[model samples]
Target: MVCITFMSTTAMAREAPIFLVAHPDVATRGLNTDTARAIFAMRQRTWPSGQAARVFVLNNNDSVHARFAKEHLAVYPHQLQLAWDRMVFSGTGQAPNLVRDQEEMRERVATTPGAIGYLEREYLDDSVQVISME
Candidate 1:
């Protein structure tokens, strides 16, 4: 039993990083890096994501989203933590929708069309084009 459990653990550890995707069409027309930053920062309201500019989170453990947030959004996870803390404890911009994994993010973005989120560079298919950071 212990050996089997360990094998399963190793299998899951080999899993790939999450990839965020969006419809290729929405990629050009909707938020670019700057606009995405603004949207993530709550500076810009509304987007191709019907959910008040869906700021897709690449799983809670994703470093990619953190890097993007710091580099483009110019904010750290702590800021978001505080923001959400306030929003939940008080009230303001609603909390971002949580997608369990990259696949879910892709599905959400593909169906909604307005949603924007980050994904692993590998998961990007012709379905969604990556918005280059400026």
Candidate 2:
């Protein structure tokens, strides 16, 4: 029998915590499983203002988004792709904001009020609300 092991060098190399940054006006913080599921699922498609929700996403190469998606969003990357496709074909809306990395996502969300996204749970800050995963 042959055995194989897979490892991610970036996972080990992430020296700082990942933060899901957002705009300043949002009045929410501290995420639980429910909120996480809602935002990530695109079920809550719009902000209270009626503006469509802007869910930012990190690159698939990033492990942090995967962990958050599986734990809180209840969906994997494949599911996310299917979701994007469904929305696109239906003309309901496109996928959430796609940021090349966490930093870009945070910066984008920070400036955009309708924006919502996830990063490593620990890196969140007061600049934005970290919706609960409950």
Candidate 1: list runs displaced more than 4 Å: 1-21, 25-34, 48-52
Residue pairs clashing in model 1 are 19-119, 19-120, 20-118, 20-119, 48-114, 49-114, 49-115
For model 1, state the Cα shift of residue 12 in Å.
23
Residue ranges of candidate 2 with Cα displaced over 4 Å: 1-21, 30-35, 48-52, 121-126
Give me candidate 1's TM-score against the actual structure.
0.65
lDDT of 1 by residue, 1-134 (tens): 35543456656765444333455555344345666666665556675444445566664456666665675567787686667667766666666666787777777766665567777766666666565553
Displacement of residue 8 (Cα, Å) in model 2 is 10
Cα displacement (Å) at residue 114, model 1? 0.7
Instruction: Provide the lDDT at 1 for model 1.
Output: 38
Computed on alpha carbons, the lDDT of every model, listed in order, comes to 0.61, 0.66
Hey, what RMSD does candidate 2 come out at? Answer: 4.8
Candidate topping lDDT: 2
